[model samples]
Target chain A: MVTMRDVAREAGVSKATVSYVVSGSSLISEKTAAKVRAAMEKLGYSVNHTARALSTAKTNAIGVVTSFRNNGACFDLSAGAYLYGIAAAARRHGYDTMLLTGDDGVEAIRSAALSRRVDGVVVLDVLIGDARVGALKESGIPAVMLGSPADSQGVDVVDSNFEAAAVSLVERLYDHGHRSILFIGWPEAVYERKLNYAVRFRASLMEACAMRGLRVGAVYAHDATLGASEVIPRALRDCPSATAMVIHNDAAVVGAPQAFERTGIRVPADLSVVTVMPDQLGEGMQIPFDSVGIDVDAVASHTVDRLVERIGDPEMSARVELLDQPMHVRGSVRAAHED
Target chain B: MVTMRDVAREAGVSKATVSYVVSGSSLISEKTAAKVRAAMEKLGYSVNHTARALSTAKTNAIGVVTSFRNNGACFDLSAGAYLYGIAAAARRHGYDTMLLTGDDGVEAIRSAALSRRVDGVVVLDVLIGDARVGALKESGIPAVMLGSPADSQGVDVVDSNFEAAAVSLVERLYDHGHRSILFIGWPEAVYERKLNYAVRFRASLMEACAMRGLRVGAVYAHDATLGASEVIPRALRDCPSATAMVIHNDAAVVGAPQAFERTGIRVPADLSVVTVMPDQLGEGMQIPFDSVGIDVDAVASHTVDRLVERIGDPEMSARVELLDQPMHVRGSVRAAHED
Candidate 1:
């Protein structure tokens, strides 16, 4: 029931100053803005967002499209981290986030675009041949992607350098004198769905090992049902000469220490181990390990920054940015002994 | 820039008919609505949500507030499942979800209410004496909570029956002829924060055990750093005669089988184990266990349904609803041996 005029009168400011503050204009000074905000708070003046948006042609909100479906089937833990990042960054920029979490991703994106409820969009869980890419482009809405899709010609994308992560993992082990190493990968379904990160990591890891002339041993999709104790021994049996291991699965890494205890393989004594996962997951483990952590927050921050920049400057060029991953050493590796 | 008039002309219908379809009013028949939609699609007519909202005072969107903060410190995985459920249910009701993931819970709700960017709100990860509850009441917004706060009067709340779950766990273990039991609870931080579910479950479990005259042994807060293997062994040492275990920690449960293997304690042979967790988690494990599964989606659906109903009918009475949890039998329990 309260109006901006009442707030301006209460604060001893002009109506235009109150308007500038409500519209989030940069023209207002911090002191003046604070005064106006305090006045608005005292007067309990709730903004009519619809009317303000109609005049300014801005919603002060962004759409975040993810693949957390209706059937409760697909939930990517790592993607959720990125989502958390965007929301926080958006809040910092004085914007809200509108989320689209249905399974019909393309349709959802199109509908969000058509309605113009948000100023921009952030896409997550991008696939190799993602249909949402075309829909986003067709909508002509400013957008950013968390995953680097197969063909991202005119879209802004920010992701962890999975290739660099793979190279770093292999080189860390190779430098430790590990020639024959066992590799543990994500589940088969991850590759089948063509999730960009999973596909990129596996391919780049194989290539990196090949380039160094390191013999890569058996690779198995981590089955959560079968804990690491069951899979690690099987992988070792396939590569009896393996003196180290590299893991890319989050669930499997949780049981790696137990697996080592059961197999009588001492860490850094008989075999070295390294895992590539989110830093939170890596650090949250009871027994930490040498790991290459994907800074998911960094990627999300970059995506949001670029999108906000593009929203302000419509003519800005699209870019693909990949951040370097940090490797934490916990003394899980040692120099191998020659027989 | 195609207008409703243009679409109506193409579809051979009145402008009012097209307006009804765009407003999502139930006055129009499905056949006529389909025709109008097809015409609008062919003409590339995108709705201007702000203008329409200004006219109708309806945004057709709901707000979801969660504590997935910017620092990347607090992400509750179980709460994420409930969020997924709300998004799906909102879409089914022809609504979109706006996410507020900032840590400033009270301010976020107040701002969201003042902005009027969403028609309703869904609050997740509620605490015992949540400040957001007061903010919601002050804003006079139609909102629902996923957790039952200590003072949830005049607000709609949907949650899993943690008390019933506790009773069921104790009775099942008691029926198996187990006289002594070891309980592994959530971290001390959970109780310190007074998360309603954790506090309620612990109290209910203790009471249920006392009622049946069961000797509950050493209760340890699950330490993820030490793992279940270390904690379980230590818990057993305190209660050497314990013949059963009840685990309420997600991270600790992941290492239970390995813990049993290390201590040479066979499940259902020397000890029986029961877990209280999300159904998805219990079902996702390669080796499933007997558990009390919280149907997160059912709770979310009910929350959304109640919120949407209240949004339509402002005078609807506030109610607290608790859905029964499903008990899964996976043969993890056995008859106790008598000396």
Candidate 2:
């Protein structure tokens, strides 16, 4: 409750001098500034963030709108990692995050935006032609999408290029003499939702296979763990002739090696597996599986940069950024032979 | 901006009636309330959260202090799950969460608390004689600790009963005819830091073993995953007579089954493993290991309840709450000797 006037009176200085010292707006003598700071500290004076935000029209808070629908039921590893990245970035920039979960409807988004609870919004799992994006644009609020919709307009997007990454994995399999490859993707990404990058990756894989005269077998897994016990066996049984498999899930990859062991299949000899998500495969949890390491740290850094940029200049033109995927060839893939 | 005056004029009602309609206080006639709502909607009038918060002196925002030091690492599954539970609970209560991470020292906590950035804080991994706890209490801020410290002077705590849970598991193992068991725990929890519930569980296991005239072998794991790979093999080799293992780490349990497999040890036949964690394990990433499920949801709900109570009545005395740990028997532990 100590005001600038109290600090000035205690320090025998003018209120303007106290304000300057506290705000660091102007140069003040070191001794005077110290005196004011000591007096303010002694009086238990703290900056009122709410009042400061109201006066400056800057909340220094970012709104994170996350959907628990679609693949949101999956473990918090993926989405949580992105959020952790954003939070870390925001902290570095002296900002805080306010999470808005399960805000599906357009009205909900508009309400959140108009309420002025946050200065900007970082949206995850944004569908093509998302209502939230439209609402944010209409309300003149800065918005950044974790993934872009098919017809992106008036929104900045920062997402991993899963489709291209999938294609690259398939090409690697093809180059290694894999004539037929099995593709395991998440179910929600393939069936119920359109925001899934795994589904797009599957389509791109099939397209690339068609152009190269290759056969691609696909299956939808409810999750990575389930995929390990259920889908991997089915993939092997249905595509016995297939020599390699491409996985777009980290959880699935972790269980795939065990699945192979259960079926008495030797990795890189009888079958091969690769994953599109690399961060989930932590340093010590390596599965000897070849992978296109999706640099999660880089993805996080880029998303933070994009969200900050959008926040700083809400009127700036919307943009879609696609980062390149790097491949880490471990011992999972091998050359297929014709018997 | 359409104020209450505008709604009153458009709806042909008094300003007090419009205010009553918006605040839902002193209920107006249904017809009059509907008319006021319609007029406000037509004029695009919305309640400003900032102004409302100022008037009510309630931000409806909870602060969650999570450290990323040692066991508080970002990728720690249990820590992440705990945070997720808190966030989900806050969302269900129509509240937003503001996470404050990396606030290690007293100064950081003091800044966060005195700034009034959040209504209350949910503190995780609280240490014995923690400086942050003292600072928070001194600031008269509402807080709930995920784990109970040995000393609880001015804070509410919600934690699992580790000793009883460990004893129950030991008894179960004894009933299954296992004479010797190996207990693996986190090194940081046991040595570097003072005794926590995990350490207490180890002590109870030792006491139970002593009571049964059997010596239990124990080892400290650097982390769950590391212990899974390194400790499992060592336990088998070093304590060749041991037939069962109780693991407290979730990540380590994920690989424990695999580690046993690598050593050509059959579960239940060569060794039995039981972990202590939540039953949900994490959606989509379920490990097949048997476990004693800690009611994490209950813990989270109770913590929130206690925090709200403390916030509403600051004069209420602080207390320690220890909840029972639910045992979830899975396929890991079996009869030591097949009848």
Best by lDDT: 1
* Cα error of candidate 2 at position B221, Å: 4.5
- CAPRI tier for the interface of model 1: medium
Question: What would the TM-scores of all predictions be?
Answer: 0.91, 0.92
* Residue A157's lDDT in candidate 2: 80
Q: Best candidate per TM-score, number?
A: 2
Q: In model 1, what is the error at residue B160, expressed in angstroms?
A: 0.8
Q: Interface RMSD computed for candidate 1 is what?
A: 2.9
> Over the stretch A245-315, how does candidate 2's per-residue lDDT look in tens digits?
88776667666655665667788888877787746545435457778777766776687778788888766
Candidate 1: TM-score, chain B only:
0.89
- Pick out the ten consecutive residues of candidate 1 chain B with the lowest summed lDDT: B68-77
iRMSD of all candidate structures? 2.9, 2.7
